[model samples]
Target: MVLIGSHAYGKLPDLPAVAQNLTGLAGALRHPSVWGLPDSHCTVLDQPESAQQALDALHAQAPLATDTLIVYYAGHGLVDPYTDELYLALPASEQGRPDTALRYEYVRRAVLDPAVTARRKVVVLDSCYSGRALIGEMGAGDHVTAQALIDGTCLLTSTAETRKALSFPGERYTAFTGELIGILVGGIPEGPELLDMDTIYREAHARLAAKGRPQPQQRNRNAGGLIVLARNRAHPHSQAVGAPSDPTLTRLAPRTVPLLRRVSRRSLLVGAAVGTAGLGGAGLGIRQLLLAGEKDAGGGVGSAPSHRTTSPPAAAPSASASSSPTPTTPPTTQTSSPGGGAPRKALKPGEVAWRKKIPATDDASDVLLVDDVLVLNLDGTLHGYDRASGERRWTLRHDAPFARRLSGAAVGSGVLCIEDENMFLQGVDIRRGTKRWGFRLATEVDALDAMPPCVRGGIVYAARTGASLYALDLATGKKRWSYSPTGGVGANPTVNDTVVCVGVLDPTGNDVCAVDLRSGREKWREEFGLIEYLAVDNQCVYTCAMGTLTGLDLATREERWSQPGVRRDPTTDLQPLTLAGGVLYTTTVDGLLTARDPWTGTVRWRFNVRYGERFATWGQWSSGGGATPIIDGQTVYLGSLAYLALPDEAAFREKNRATHFVHAVDAATGTERWHFEAGGATGTTAVDATTVYVASSDGYLYGLAR
Candidate 1:
């Protein structure tokens, strides 16, 4: 048996789901009736080249026909649009280039070719582009002799080439793998002894379609006799499709939410470290704090926003703290009620102006709003649409020539800076979406996928994933200077005129270090936890992994206030803080949309946005609170849906799992002004003056009038 996957990717964000898929299948195959937990014969490969080596060795060492070879692979599977070929990436493999990835032909020759002696062969693919393997190359019908057809050869693919395999938020395995494991453990209708290869594929396909997921399928090859895989270990009386997953076998980790937005340079989860230390060891009980107006540096005894320009941070309506609050008394949910002073003008999220649906695409980044254009990266192309009309404006196929993955543009300095996973940075004219300048990395240096570059003052401040930091001229893509640190580099730099703040780590502890933007000299380094995200405008660093949000002085690097464990319900933590229109917003695992004071960590208001009472049947679906909140001018929007994270992993991903909603709340007052009850709601949100755009996991991008 061969199990291969690449989870520790260097040039791209690591997919934790890969690890889940690997371990889940490995456990299922070891059932007593299957392989009987035979550790000696199984081979596991994590690297791309290593998998090829193992396959080549198999051909040289072809042995007996009794040997049944089983193959399982889960990773980033890319289909070259130019060549119409599919390639599977290894840990060190590059995205677009075929040389770095394992080609499908190699897999076909190693496993499907008659020259190899294995009589029984089965291949299972669980990936985005996995279905491509069963197309033209492996077409059915007459091919060669009847002797080859008699051999019990089978192939199972996760989804059609056009659809993407969905990931569970906190479950151990993906939707496809989880269902497959259940069937192998539980006996079929005819019992485990009489189960055939076709039954396995058909059962998995039914399970996927039932969950509103892309249907997995099998072709003409599943025509063998009964192939007993394992003894039925599930309860004899129970006949549920998913009743076989052993509770003991389900491995659980600290529940984590994967951020899908592209506003930051690197993914917030990967670019951070969840250390034991909390906010430099400052422990403050934030559970009972009431909503209070934001106080400036001197007013609240905390550091103020950097005074680089003459203008100060926007003033919010002052809200005084409430008297001793009991646990039962939640924060007030009044829309026009400003706590301490006169009511502020509540934002009116006007009715829908227009709603349109965009074509479903692959690996899409969050919808971006730049210069009145809504931009989203799909497959190998970047599409721009009119923010109001939803009309196609321009399509940027810059990466089409190389087929490399394009980083969403970081717009500033009249240019849009894009970083490719292959270590090439390009500057494009923002309005025209035309490439103006490009810079390629030297051979000796490696690019970091977790540390994205930030553009400020016509300069780009970026850190290499495994090396040092560099500042580049945005207009010309020229390196200004480089600073080599001792260890790995992190992303989301908070750049002010005086210094650029970066998160760095070494053997000791995680730290937030400051460097002089002009000189590239270290100004100060503070012992702090690895930062999940840094808000530069307010000099705030948040570690969502630890549930701590700390404010810092950009000039002095001193701690203003630290709010550790500031979540409404402790089931899951808040997403990294998002700042817009002078207000900070984040969602909680318990379905609370929270607005906080920028400097003092005071609660502005909290709104409960659960799916419904019917959803209460499943206690908590998903890491329910991980959906991100978007701030559009004076309004805050959230996509709220329930996902069954426990009990059953695939319960919530249904064609109709229950009704879902996208809410528009007044930023200042935490009151729902308007809402759109679109089912299968997600955090993929972007807004303009006229409309709001949202994407559902069910392959639909909806445009709603605001």
Candidate 2:
């Protein structure tokens, strides 16, 4: 298997951050499974080149009889407003508008042409406004003939046109790429039975959507013919391939410490039955039963006599205790508290591993792990940490600081890229944590209120706060190209091999655009007045607009299918998307999180967090505020604020004060796991294998052990 990326990070004036993200992407692709085809048969091309050169090389390569070829991109995309044509952004010094960027038609003709290869081709895009670029009609940016390609092409994009893509502070790639790497690196299961391309695309889209960005879209033309070779699978003969040779696999191993088992099977069954009966209705009873299974085993109703009394008092007696004489001293005589004596501290400093303080800022937005480094965005400064020891490595501060609010980061090659509230792009060195270059919009604009910048190849793609989009180089901080809309650019851009896609907001509503990465030319544009977010797969681009979600063809930008009744508001900042275990997860402003079918957008399960109590006060014109949902395997995390007045009348009048609470839920089924109260939490949450990390307005970073 081979993966190739053609990314343009706009221009390089002084930003090394773009370069860092690109470098990190290169490193991710360097994994053995991605390019180690039996005997190292894969090649990567991230160098600067003209659209013609890139297409020519792709066309020249001989078709493979049996194998897979994966092509990826991270840059700018364009779309033609009149004809809905798509294009890819490229490095063109002469052309500065959207009319001259690389077109998708050209890419199709040169690289995806059916005659060029018999092997399956997989294309992944991490650019702004990528959905529009994939399937729309060829336009001025369409520099190549349309009748030049064959079939068996697979396509994937980061977001739809209406939503923005993000780059967190420490991420080596955009959220899309980070998730992709996570999937490829075993964060997601790999196998023919685990998930197909369509499923993966849908999951990826949902995951992104939950975070307030559009989901990645996909298109698979060959149905079952498109084969996704796992990127992290090792050779069968490798030493790590077989079952564990250690005794721990079959028996206890040496030096192993034993953990106490807290709950018994009888206790669990009894607790579940009682909890179920207490919930009242059948649906709630079922929900409670499920919740019972998820609760801390030792903390269930069966373990507490007082909890059972709080209900109708018809609860059954403990099953275990009924069979034996009750001890005079109760269960406390049999077992001690898990903590022994004192209440355990929420988080110990030693458990912190490492900590670094932001000079003058109190808030940070995103964090990511690239190779052995941890990157953090603290207010306006970008900090790097040694992943192993959590030691401070370096820091990069913005010379012309925009907003104190930091957004996201993307690391490539050796550069670290980040964005601010004003949509300013900054690039830094990963090793030294020093600023390499930076760029400001010729016109002051904000891409989307909370969206982050994305980097690919050596280009950085960012959406201004108003309505303009830009692509810049990582090394020199030069402006490669820019795109402005009659409406504002609301969505972040997603880049594939030869195209970029973004969402635009006008007085009438929302639309998606496909742009060329190299020349800043547009290929096609599609309008959906109600759409808010987008996701891509190999065969189609999925979008959520108005109150519905739909899929569009990648090659022709035509609507393939539509799923209705999926509505979200503008103030609902996060994308609310996640993909895992062949499922797409999304959250809405109404406090509902859903797991849906990626192909059809049908609801699989819906989880509600609303508790019928107003939690907090809202600014003028705002209904309510909530954080985006986060998913880790079978667990989902959510945070929100609600208000409650001292008097019922005052509360009903919306005059009550509110408090915030953080919740953890099960991803497979909509069930609450645990909840912790806090002042407020913004942005997304991060997780390691053993703990969950969250930041709040209370001036404390919380570490919740799993």
What tens digits encode model 2's per-residue C-alpha lDDT throughout 7-62? 33345111122343344444433433232223233334454466665555455442
- Local error of candidate 1 at residue 44 (angstroms): 79
Every candidate's CA RMSD: 29.3, 18.7
Badly placed stretches (over 4 Å) of model 2 are: 1-366, 370-411, 414-416, 421-423, 430-432, 442-451, 465-467, 485-488, 505-507, 564-584, 610-617, 620-667, 670-682
For candidate 1, the 10 contiguous residues with the lowest summed lDDT are 271-280
Q: Candidate 1: misplaced stretches above 4 Å?
A: 1-351, 362-365, 398-409, 439-448, 538-545, 567-574, 588-592, 611-628, 639-660, 679-681, 695-701
How does candidate 2 score on lDDT?
0.44
How far off is residue 488 in model 2, in Å?
A: 5.1
TM-scores for the candidates: 0.45, 0.47
What lDDT score belongs to each candidate, Candidate 1 first?
Answer: 0.49, 0.44
What is the alpha-carbon lDDT of model 1 when measured against the actual structure?
0.49
Question: What digit string (tens of lDDT, one per residue) describes model 1 on residues 1-706?
Answer: 4456677677755667677666656665554333343464445554445545645544443332234455566676766644445677667666676676677657656654566554445566777667566433110000000111112445566765445666655545566766666565443442322233444554555445434456664432222212233333331322223344444333321122334342252322221000000010112111111011001101001111111001001121112212111122111111122111222232234333344565544222345554445665554466676643566677777652322222223554335556655566667665566778776643245444534456554566665455567777766778888766667555445554356777777565567777887788888777777565665442454433256777776646677777764555565555545544334556664567776666676777887764322245555544333455665433567764333322323554452332346777755567776776553435436653334676543445566645
